[model samples]
Target: MSEQRVRGVPAQPSAPDGPTPKRLPAGGQRGGPPWMGAGMPAERSLNFGPTARRLLRRLRPQRLHLGAVIGLAVVSVGLTVIGPKVLGYATDLIFTGVIGQQLPSGTSADDAVAAARAAGNHNFADMLARMDVVPGAGIDFPALGRVLLLALGLYLAASLLMWWQGWLLTGVVQRTVFQLRAEVEEKLNRLPLPYFDRQPRGELLSRVTNDIDNISQSLQQTLSQLLTSLLTVVGVLGMMFWISPLLAVVALVAVPLSVVVTGQIAKRSQRKFIAQWTHTGELNAQIEEAFTGHDLIKVFGRRREVEAAFHAKNEQLFQASFGAQFISGIIMPAMLFIGNLSYVAIAVVGGLRVASGAMSLGDVQAFIQYSRQFTQPLTQVASMANLLQSGVASAERVFAVLDADEQIPDPAAPVRFTDPHGRVEFERVSFRYDPDKPLIEELSLVAEPGHTVAIVGPTGAGKTTLVNLIMRFYELDAGRITLDGVDITELRRDDLRGRIGMVLQDTWLFGGTIRDNIAYGRPDATEEEILAAARATFVDRFVRSLPDGYDTVIDEEGSNVSAGEKQLITIARAFLAEPALLILDEATSSVDTRTEVLLQRAMAALRSERTSFVIAHRLSTIRDADLILMMEHGRIVEQGTHEQLLAAHGPYHRLYQSQFHQAAGGDDPMPVAAASTAG
Candidate 1:
């Protein structure tokens, strides 16, 4: 498939027929109207087991901290479980005091207890014996005060432990996220160029920024909470069984039912959560595309179309999100209802037991409290299922990036050049982005040291792909590319690329001072060297004109500067690198005619002692080239000097006649010549 050239840089090649732009269907995929589909990519299914395992593996580095956090959570939950029982003890003390005051004035304690047992009030009698009762005397105020104080202390300690656990967990979560983000950034750098070509930048950014943030928040808020919930359930259940096994059995019945309900709801809701984020990523992609191409959209009068597209995506996102939240939302209330039913049943049965002296009032109260505690955690855990699902989905996205295949790895024992002179050669090289379609086949060329090799080709003739191969950005499907007689694949990528400098058609500059941007390739460059490179690129005139000169900070993508100025700064960066080989892919396309002349003069000087490959549409720019390789269909159709090609009257001859000749005010003898040659 032929690739389209954007100004000067060739677009990545696609299928011969090209990918059909996905159109909004007349009736959408689901049989709705044209606007219903939102054109979103299909959502990927979640494989929870593997993804969860991979995510947990990332926490290996923080295992010690995580273990400590779990320990603290256990301690905090233990105190929480003990605190309620202690409060029940205080209640028993108050009940005993009140009952002692109500005893008949003349009745002896032993006789009263015996009469209570005879009436099947054995539990009441047991309580009477435990109380320090004096006939017609009030309750023991000191003992009740002590019990209340103990309950108060237990609660206070539980609160303190919870606060401390949260504090420790926050640091652990932040650090883990920081490490995760760092690894993702590193992985991006290592990934092959093809990986990027297949995905949108905004979607990848969503994974790195948004997905990671979700995982971080879940860890911070939900991880400890989940652990505490489990611990509370275990501790509360133990206390319940200790108080009364029969009551514990009744409470346990709700456990399986809650699990069944939660599982059924979560099984459906998880997919929706995955779809929600998928749609969210699509929405982000749309916004990123619109903002980046705002000028194009305005110029084309596509505002209505853009808005309609965004609306469709927004609606889809809303549907997915609402479905996920609504389904998951049933868990908390469902668990609550089930929990309350169990509580009511336990209350009725326990009340009967207390009346028949089968259980004490305080014991029943404690059992009821334990039942609440038991169900409370179950409800909490059911609620957390949603967060866990969302987190797992986010984690799956993040891990997908981390697991992406990296660029063809560097050799086990890489070679390097010492004092290298750039003499590149392609030996029977064959490459194709897709194996089904071969682009460059048996392509062979030699670029001698310190010579300017100008590659002239129609779009999709593999001009940019050739340079990409030289830079080792894409590996050859067959054969080898060598630099100064050393096979490039055997050389360390850093070492090979260190000696090669590229100034692409699209200039990129980070947010930094002009000097910093210029010194990007060589961070340790001196002020003198920076100024020299800037002067060579004719950027010094503009730099000196600015109030801050070299210190002027450029906005992101150098938006603060004009396009032409950004290109000059990038050229200055390349010059500062002082590489042995230089690839100028339409480097001067953005500059004005006058600036182009100055740049040509500077390039001429730089090209004299360094190997350079120039790709440009302007034939006049390469008139002085040492060798010009005319390419067609990824083959070298012609080769030699500018005069040699023009005299040959071949493809390059026609291109010059139609483009350069017309630009120079010559009569347009063949207006269709360029297109014919391109075909």
Candidate 2:
């Protein structure tokens, strides 16, 4: 689908397609292809603690709601304590009733009758025990009913509180993730250019998609179960100690052993989780690379090789994922086993105490319940450790990008150039991408206002690097470049770039109407000015012939446009910018002879009021240039007017003659000497 730009263009109409027109060879256009994802690096982490902490920091803004959710958890667990207590009281009352029915044989009939009557509670005696608790067997049925009703109320309250907690926690999780993703997107725009250079798009996307998903999974697993289990553990422990401290001590014997087991599972899972995310990124990279280069693979008859490469990456991901899950999977069963063992110990030890009259039946029951509560949270914490580690790995990656330095810092004090005279000078400038190898050394030049300077060189002769420096795409290693006698570095980067216009050999047309692409360099330009720029580049005639004219929808990278048409549109864009300095690098190299003539005319027109730098291959294009500079091996070898260079019969003369021979479709050197002597 073609994108529409909201600039100076008519509404575009759709077009049918097989292979739509474009500016260059389909895969080579810049401004980053639409198919490419945001490129950035992934996490390098095997540490869960730091990652979890960072995720928590992301949640700080929503702490108030989270606290309310935890409060609900406590209420839910409070009901758990009351439920079993009610059942125990009811059991004690039933036992008491059975015992009350009989008396000793020596007792008188009147005394026996009185004892039986006393066993049935009077109004005064019933008042001593609270109505909500199960009365002793000496009391009536209404009291037992009240105990059941109270338990029901506690159970209902717990359910209600739990529902509310789930609702709030889910909202918090979603909102927190939304904010995190938004921040990640913002950081993508702010990161330095080199960060993208070092990272793959697929891996970067994995950080945003797969990693963020892991964080959400962690939240879902940890918050709900962990909070409820923790409260249950505390409430059960409190009840246990209340009933019989001795039995409670025996039930906790499994706590230290459970801790050791849980620690081992978590430690193993941490490494596995890290490896898992790494493999996931690798797998994503392979899939992205395969899909993007499918045509190339087919052309080279490498489909089998591509599949094998894909299989290897997929297998690694599967192994890592399986290992992490396996380790994490052990945690729950280990927890259940330890809880069961603790229950058996509590049951055996407490039953003996009860039989010896040292404890009650209710106390033994409560102690076993408490043991489950203790083990449950420990189990939950163990299982969540794996998910938490995955989230941490993702968090580390996100933070790494957020913390990366921005490529261009805005100047504190900025100089702006308006109506520049375009007197550009480079003084003893040197540059290198890596410090160990220099691209250009001690390069110095001066271009006076309104003069065209053409730089000629072999491949890797630092021609493009020199142009990049002029555009300030890369900073120089030493010395400086100035425009109108003002240091370019001191100017705001945006302002510095704004005053200069550049046109490259390969032109990119964005997915938009013809007018929209042309107006990209000046959004507020009037329609008349837009058309005038198109006319200046001689593109207006072709555009007018199209069905929708200026409203024609260009395909991705202007694939629906011809190379010459795309170049014309780019030139139109530069024309709209109306800058004082124009830089054209190999601008007409891809055009046919017919289009080349039109391009030369358009370039000549644009160069009238501007200081222009032309990087040329066809010597005829620059025969009229003010000066020609020849470069080789990062150093300037010659500089003179075209006629003077031809007179010298140096490298320029030989290069000109070689091109003449190629134009004649021959390999002879006669054209070289002939052209040199004729000049």
Candidate 3:
């Protein structure tokens, strides 16, 4: 937007500078195709600690719910831990009852033990002495039944509590993930366009889609299990010491060894998990690129290269995933082996203790059960290390987006343009894509209200870049641009862009009915107004031939429609918007000569009372333009009317001669390069 707007008193509204269309071809411009998933640096991890902490912070909002779940887990584990001990009492009752039935009536327990000793069974006598059995009494069926019933109740209660906690944990975990996904989406909207320019579209989508999903799955599988397993370990350990301290000590011996095994393997698997997710994102980016540019790929005949790239990425993902799973897989069996060793040691020591009258047979039985319970939870935790690592890796990617630099915030009190007169001015404006390479420098110009201004420039001559400055797609490095005598930056971006209508060289039509797509320009537009635009742009003409007419559905890529037809629809969309300022870039390039003539006529009507900035290569179309600008190397080398520029015989004259001279079958010294100006 050069000579774009100025600070001037209200003047009679003439018309916007004419022909606001660009002429650059679709290549080498910073504006790559919408579907091209290229560029952008990947998110790398220095440590999972912060990411893991951040992931847990997502649960902060659900702390109350999580607390309730933890409470239930603790109660459930308490009941579960007490179960084996209660069952051990029941076993003792049965054993003592059977032994008592063999004794004489009314005999003392001491007498039974002495009799066993007299029979030369010293260990058996000692075991019998440790038991609280009456020699004369038969099986105490009532007491045994009560012990069995109590054990069953405790186990049933534990299972019910576990189910309830799992249900609650599911809700909490899902809600946390839902909020995380929403945050990522909100963060994307706040990021500047430059951020998107640097990042691959597919990598971004993976962070939003795949990474979020993996977090949800990982939390759901691990949170409650980890909570319950930890509680079980503590409760079972306490119970083990209560039953037999010697066996408990034996069980404790495996803890450090299990820790060492898990720590060593987990360290190896974490890196693999990170690589696995990174490769997954790269592979996804490639697939999205291949699918979106499928037709282009086929035309270029680089199918083999695309396939090889995909194969390489897919193989990397496979290797990472395999390494992560395989390394973590060893933890479970290693834990189980250690656990079995402890179990055997406990059994042997407890058996000797029971025979020596130091512990009861019932206690020994419970001690063995506690040892198994203790090891089982440790194994579960060790096995879950891979999942935790993978989840944290994904969390780091998502957090990267959330932590990215956002665009400057909109002003609290923004200037409003109730009636923008389309007076755009660039005052000593300077900009550069790279810090070292300057593009436009100290450019000053003004586009008067309601006059057609055509900008003709060579490729990379900062034509589109000028319009981009007006649109604030990139922040200006120096100087300022204004619309309607007000600084563009002073206005809300939405308020500024809402008043301008633009059509690009590359047509974009989302999946929808023809009517809906047209209505997209102005959702509040009336049916009559919509049809009027279609008629003016000549869309209504060909649309009538379709069986569905205005109701005809278009796919995402608009593959069902011809290129010219799609262009017509977009033109109709711009017309329907009824914008105060019009910026058209190669608006008529896709049409046939007949349609181009009609579109030019329709564009003239559209420009009747509006300010327009047109970037044009077809000098014939802009012959009637009020002000013509010839730009080379980002500076306005020449500025005048068509007839005036022809008289001057400068660069614009050479550019003009190269075009019409060839059309008339007359050779000019200078050849007309295909469409001048960068996009």
Candidate 4:
């Protein structure tokens, strides 16, 4: 039989979800029309300037492509801005042709203009003197056609180049975003387990998924447009000044006004944009928890409570999104109003200059068009401030993840484990989840090759922490742990973990066939070896009963199978790995008594000629173990054979008596004095 390919993806993620961020007590997001942009749903100090700079740096690799895109934009804007002035020439041609045709055919230019002045058409005479037209000319169709065709060619070329620029920019921006995602994925893997402990999976996923996606979209939509608009402003400003300096200065008055207005709104709305995306992440976390814990929520009949929480988060998100959009939305209209005021002033001044013959009528016409063109780009820039703010906010969140503290790196020259012995030891190992509250302190122990060490402890007694330290999931705060007398830190993490196999208390299975999941432990396992592992762990019986047998599909959450079935599959996986050292933290607690006995026999065979550590509350399973260690409050209180510990009547004895007595249908609660002493 061919082996099925299994994905490395983990199960549908959601264990104990973290709490939502605290909601603001009052002020920012109730839509009270606080024009100063006061009340915020939630707020944090975002490094806006630095984050935007970092985002720009992501485009550095595409500098050549960016240069080409910018060059295209400049050429396109130049041609587009020149169109109005060229069309104004056509307007002058028609006006001068009509005026000259109304005069006598044999008249000279000086006599015609003198006649107009004598007839009290002084402005008309001044305009005629300014124009260059033949005395006998009517309309010159060929000349007019040439000017129109020239205008058409300029605009057509500009449009084509603009299209090319947009296409090139799309490729450049997408490539940059692709690189950013790869970096983010690599960063997630390098972060330590404790970092994950501090972050909720859903929130982390949001930064990786939603926030990065927002950044990509923001760049794609605005980058090209912003470049074009700014370039257009420069092109139009030059044209306006060349036409008439007076009207150009009149148009320049609106720039500072627009800048001041936009800056005020932007400064206030940026924090709101940050709050908006934060609310989105928090809301996403709540939804993920509610989805994964749907069964638990229903079983506990806390449906109303969950709904109420969802409603509150949903409302917070709505308020924040609305505030960010509405406050920033004001920029477009405010800018348009300022530009209009400048437009009216320029129009009034240009007309006076044209009537005084200081400017030609065609120049005044082109100047009006230039003023509109100049103000338009500013309006466009103001309109995009919200999107820019939103994207920067998301980028800041993603940057935070990338900048987090990574795990202590592997040694430069790692020690090789050519052939691992089963021996393991803790040399005065001290560690804690928190510095102020020590959990494990100066604890030392040893396990000889081919020995079984059964750890018996109540909840919160550091049983799991001990095993985790063995795996190097969390670094020790002090002291050292070793395998075969060499410090574990000296060995590469993968090399050390490769020699150890673990079956954690929480079972996880990816989306794959049963065969694939079992083969995940050793992808090259033979068919016979896989069947042997399945039979040994009691998974064979249930798997054969399924319609697809070993090929039966397991959902991402493994929800189609029973909990015991999932546990059996994971055990079979560990068995197939065939590592030198084994750690089982309540590996068989899910199976029934009938199945437990069979697993114990299989485990014993597997434990033979190898080292193993078993953690269990069921005392009967570890009775024949070579050594037994009882832990309390992060310290091992006793270690000996099971019989020896029972004779000693220590905490292990009290725990064993309570369990055995219960099995025999009798109450054997520890005495008050004994419990106090144990504490």
Candidate 5:
């Protein structure tokens, strides 16, 4: 595909019911205001040489196009100056020689009388008195025509050149934007998960979608405007100096003043812009949260509460945006006021020069026009200062994400896992979500290859944390997790992840067909493989019962499918992956008893040749597990076969008894297990 094409376009034409990957968090999104501007001034001290160079390199492909556009700008700017020069010359001719010429229309006496009055020499009545006042000398029709034609041609050429520049500049900007967007997306995929944990998804979304968009828009506007403004400024100043250096000097006093004023405004507004963007992100986050939890809000009759929360965030966004724009808006009127003052000064000075004959009337007129043209660019430059600053801020934001160094990089030399036999071992691994709060302390476990290892625990027991470690989602604070005696960190993340499959309680289905959903884990799988995988998970029966069978589209997050069907499709996807390690985290929680039995059979088939980690609310699902690790407050309190634990009549036994009796409609508390395994 061309660079203009959006990236991540699928390679195959599949049934459109596939599941998409979860939206990864953006870097700047973590724990901050949503509407923050690009880069902090403090961050500029850090090296961005690489990012600048990279941006320049990306623009290199469009260098030829940019060069052509700039060449056109040069021609256009030349005409912009020359067009007024032509008019000035014509004006000079009219003042010095044209009025006394014979009238082209019917030679009326009144016309001759008016010419005589304009000349103040009665030359029209006494033709021989002044030889320079003859009709051809005064009129010069052919010369006039040539001057008009030349101006017209220059005007047309300049217009055409401007058009071409505008057209080509768009191509350059859009292509660069497309490439940058694709690269940013790819980088997000490669970035370590911990980077996401700290940032908010809404903030990241604003950066990627809003900030990057701002950068792209700013780049286009700045490139075109900066080039044209610079060229026009230079050309007009050159003409002004050519006409009268004194006037040129007077007009330019405002240039430096304008710059100073613009800089002051920029300095003041930068923080505000940052704050505006941060608040916008916060507002977006709140809106997303409220919308996503709309059902909960309605069920709880908290619509008014949600609206109040929304209004609070909206007001914050409004204040920030208004403040930022108000500061930026100060530039235009200030520039125009300065420009008007410069115009008045130039006119007063030039009028004196014209009266004294130090300069011709035409020369004074051209100087006035040129002075205005020169300051026009200055005014534009001042106005666009805001856009440039915004761009830089946006660049800083985008680069902040690109420059984040807090990710867990794989070892320099990654180990190859040719045939992954998933024997996971956590050797004395102690972990904390935060250093001040210990979540799992001195945790160690060994799960043999091709065995179902069940972990039973209440909320916050760190069962999920164990699976996360196995997947290397979060690095251990102090411990090593090895797979078949090799450190998992040494393995390439993609290679390591490819060997594992997971089915979460929150099943995510994208806008695609059931067939596509089933083949999501194996993109290149055949239709037959998709159908077989679905049948294994008992998803095919439901899919086939649908109006269009597997061909039916599951748009809007598979809203058309039942929750149980969504779970079944997720199971089918995992089955298709056929990984060496499978994790089922409350996988069957949404399914009914009949569906649960079918899901168990699917799990049995998937786990036959793979090590499985199961976190189930229903203890019966894991009763036959090879090892049941009973966890409490981040430590494994009991570990053994279900029967052995039951026979031991300790922590696991009492807990199982309470749950087992509860299933039989009894209410009771069980004996507590020791806090830690050693205890």
Candidate 6:
């Protein structure tokens, strides 16, 4: 296949035989095509403590609702804790009834009670006080029924409260995530252009969408479980001690050991989780690039290369994810083992205590249940550690964007333009994209109202940089720019940019009707004004051919239309805006020759009585410009009218001859210069 052309540039040269595969970079692989692996430095090494603190700080706005959720969780857990103990009481009552039934005929109730007391069973003695028992009666069925009913009610109430807690927490999580998403979007707008230039679009997108979603999921699922587990641990420990201090001490032995084991495993898992998510983001970036650049990849026969890169990242993600999960996966079983050990200790010790008549069977049963409950929460907390770690990792990435440096701020007190006349002046301006590498230095120029100035240069000659400085997209390191004799820096950015209209080599038209796209700079444009602007830019010619005319919808980036057609629409938009100043940067470069002719005509009409700055690669387009600045390196090499520059035989003269004279198959340059001057 013939070489495929990329936008605004010539086709890329074919690769050499046996092309070397691209490798992902070190230090988490900082830059590549979005999908190959663009690592965000901030997410590489996470400080769990600080990230957690900041995440909590973000919850300050929702603290009131969070507090309420906590309260409900506590109430629910408390009710749940009480249910088992009440059931244990019912068991003791049944045992007592069986014993009463087994007593010999004519045995007195007081004699049986004395015999139970003689066995050193205080709980049995207390049960007798609460119940009216005949020596031969089997049981107090009514009392046991009531106790069982109360336990059932408590369990039901706990379930209801848990549901309510989940409901409230859902709202809190959603609202918090909503606010976080909003902040990320706002941060994107505030970040400097350089930040976006350095970061992949897909990486930033992952932070906003994927990372934030992880955090939301963690809060929704794990947070409530954490609260319940903590409360359960505390309540169970208290109940254990109430049953028998000896068994409670035995159960306490497992708490510190479980904590130590979980902590060690969690620390290792945290790093793995960070890597896992980082790799996920890298993979996301790769997918975005692959899809967006699908045509490029296919045209270049890079399917194997693309798949190889993807496979490499996919493997890395798999390994990291598996490591994290496998390490965290150890927590549940390990905690459960320790919990079982505690349970056995309690059972053995309690059995002996009951045999010695120091503890009732009912109390031993309750103590064993409490021991199981205590260990159950420990296991839950251990399981949640992985989720908490992953969430913290995601939160770290989200916060990194929020903490990025913003664009240069506006002045403390901004000035406003009044009755602007579009007289622009650049005075001794010096600027650089990086301080070490200067692009434009000590440059000065003045553009009077309603005049056309053409800036021409080879690539990297600061032609576009001049326009960027004029637009205040980047602030100058030194000197200043003025619009209509007022310092532009002092004016509000909106006020300064509002008066200028720009149409670039790359035209931008959002998904909208042709009319809407044309009226983008002037949304309030009337139908007649829109039609007139379209006609002026020759955009109506094609719009009329369309089935829906001006109302036809275009796809995003205006892909539904031809490139030339998109350019004409953008030109029409500038025409409708009717700004005091206009900037056309290689505006005719992408169109075909015929379209270029029509565009040049339309542009001539638009330039009438308007201050215009035209940056062009085709020297023929700006032959009639009133003032031409020929640039090389970072400064203007020559400045003159077209005929005068040709007469002078300077840098502009040499450039014109090399382009036009060679293209015309003429070696002699003087005659062409003479003919141009005569014309």
Candidate 3, residues 1-679, lDDT tens digits: the string is 1111111100111111212222221111222332232222233443878778878988989999999999999999999999999988988888788878878877788888898899999988888988888887878989998999999999999999999999999999999998998887777766665566545567678889999999999999989889999999999988988887778889999999999999999998887888887777777878887898999999999999889878877777888889989998998999999999988989899888987888877788888888889999999999888888888888887777788777777788999877788998999999776666667889988888888889886777777778767766667889999998999889877777778777766676779999988877788889999999999999999999999999899999899999999988888888888887887777788898899999999999988688888888677778888898898777899999999999999989988876667656656554455554233
Residues 141-239 of candidate 2 have per-residue lDDT tens digits of: 586678778878888998999999999999999999999888877777555333454455676788888888878887877878878877887887788
lDDT of 1 by residue, 108-226 (tens): 77777887889988777776665545555566679878877887787788888788888877888888889999888888777765666556656767888899999998777787878
Each candidate's TM vs. the true structure?
A: 0.91, 0.79, 0.91, 0.91, 0.85, 0.89
Per-candidate local distance difference test? 0.79, 0.71, 0.80, 0.80, 0.73, 0.79
Off by over 4 Å in 6: 1-44, 109-135, 666-679
**Model 4 misses residue 571 by how many Å?**
1.0
The digit string of per-residue lDDT tens for model 4 on 146-263 reads: 9999999999999999999999999998999899999988887776665665455566788889999999999988898899999999899989888888888899989998999999
Q: Candidate 2: TM-score? A: 0.79
Candidate 3 ranges with C-alpha deviation above 4 Å:
1-43, 136-138, 666-679
Instruction: Residues 614-666, candidate 6: write the lDDT tens digits.
Output: 98777889998989999877788899899999999998888787567754775
Model 2: residue 323 alpha-carbon error in angstroms? 1.5
Q: All predictions: root-mean-square deviation over Cα?
A: 5.3, 8.5, 6.1, 5.8, 7.1, 6.6
Which segments of model 4 are wrong by more than 4 Å? 1-43, 665-679
lDDT of 1 at 181: 91
- Give the C-alpha miss distance for residue 528 in model 2, angstroms: 4.2
Give the alpha carbon lDDT tens digit for every residue of 448-550 in model 5: 9999999886666788778877777667888899998899989876677777788877777778888877777788888888888888889888887899999
Q: Give per-residue lDDT, candidate 2, residue 52.
A: 67
* lDDT agreement of model 6 with the native: 0.79
